[model samples]
Target: MRASLSIVSLLAGAVAAAPAPKIPFVTATDVIPAPAVNARQSASQACFVIGSETLPKEVSDVAAALASSVTCDKSATTIANVPDVTSGSTTFSSIDFSQSSQTALQFALSKFATANPLADTDLQTFQDMLDVYQATEAGIRSVGGSLAIKVPKFFLEMQVSRIQTAQGNPPTAAGLQVDHLRDKVLKNAPRESKDLLDQVTQLATVLS
Candidate 1:
């Protein structure tokens, strides 16, 4: 009976000592829908029009002119009077600004890229934009909430290195702006989003 008791004790001790199973970390890609990803891509491309060198000077000038005409009126139901551009075969006429910010940005990029082959700088910019978006999206999705403000904050934090590499200039001003915006937005976020933001912040700490 003593021997059996000793064996049982050892088995119990072993079971007690076993480590708990680790929960898997959710990545940014895990949460971002395919449409969001595409939208971001499009937005990145659209932003390229502003500074692309591959296009003719006249075309770039026209793009610059048209950009000023596109107002950022979020309260409005639609973006009014978006310009169009025709590239080799694709023609992008108008983009609905009421869509996700990324989607709106994509409309801009598509219009810009339509006539202009993307320069090396433009490609780098797109990649930088994508990296930040993915990282932020992953953080937001991993924790599961509305913490969208965290996305921009995380992007600004993570994008500095990429922007420096791609543009030869740090995004210090832009980062600060995003940080400030995040702070302001966080104050208005719902309880669930705030909670998710905390989780994402923790993940960011680990990632950093």
Candidate 2:
């Protein structure tokens, strides 16, 4: 629950500062080494800060979509609708279930936010973007080629934040599982994901 709380609040925060990164274009000639799962994730995150400078359109569109969706969903303001960021696609049993954890989550976030608000914001967006990027990457991993993902700049920042933060302690066992999920995205992303990546690159190129 503490983990999920971090996931949701972090994402929400990241969403608040999105779509500012520029896009870039380059030929997919360099077959960069598949990043160590954590390294790949870290690079994914750095892209966010990179995005703000790059301001890719693909990222902005996603941020707008997510922000709009939240605006339209009345229940979203409540923790229940936010979903258990730690759980798999399921809502929590009750606000009580969430409230039990909310205090802790907020505490941790607040503490981190107090010391590193910018990093926290970046971490949130990166994790949020994973759901989309993973679905895309999973498909391409088997195909043998570079894949692209047009992640929101905010989302990218969040991933980079997490990766950067993880560097200090190297993450716990649970954190390892989270890394696996991210690895799934890089290993399995498909054409659509590749397209998104290409889009990001193009946007970056144009913006640059």
Tell me, by TM-score, which candidate is best. Answer: 1
lDDT of each: 0.36, 0.33
Scored against the true structure, residue 115 in model 1 reaches a CA lDDT of 12
Compose the digit string of candidate 1's lDDT tens values, residues 72-184.
Answer: 22232211222233232222222222344553223322322211211133434443333323222322232342434343333333333333434445346653343443443
TM-score of 1: 0.24
Please give each candidate's TM-score: 0.24, 0.21
Model 2, position 133: C-alpha lDDT score: 38
For candidate 2, the TM-score is: 0.21
Q: What digit string (tens of lDDT, one per residue) describes model 2 on residues 1-208?
A: 9999999999999998797777876768956677454323332232111121222344333333333122112233222122222112322222122244333222222222212332334444344444333322222232332333222212233344355544443344453333443443334334334554343333222210
For model 2, state the Cα shift of residue 201 in Å: 21
> What range of 10 consecutive residues in model 1 has the weakest lDDT sum?
111-120
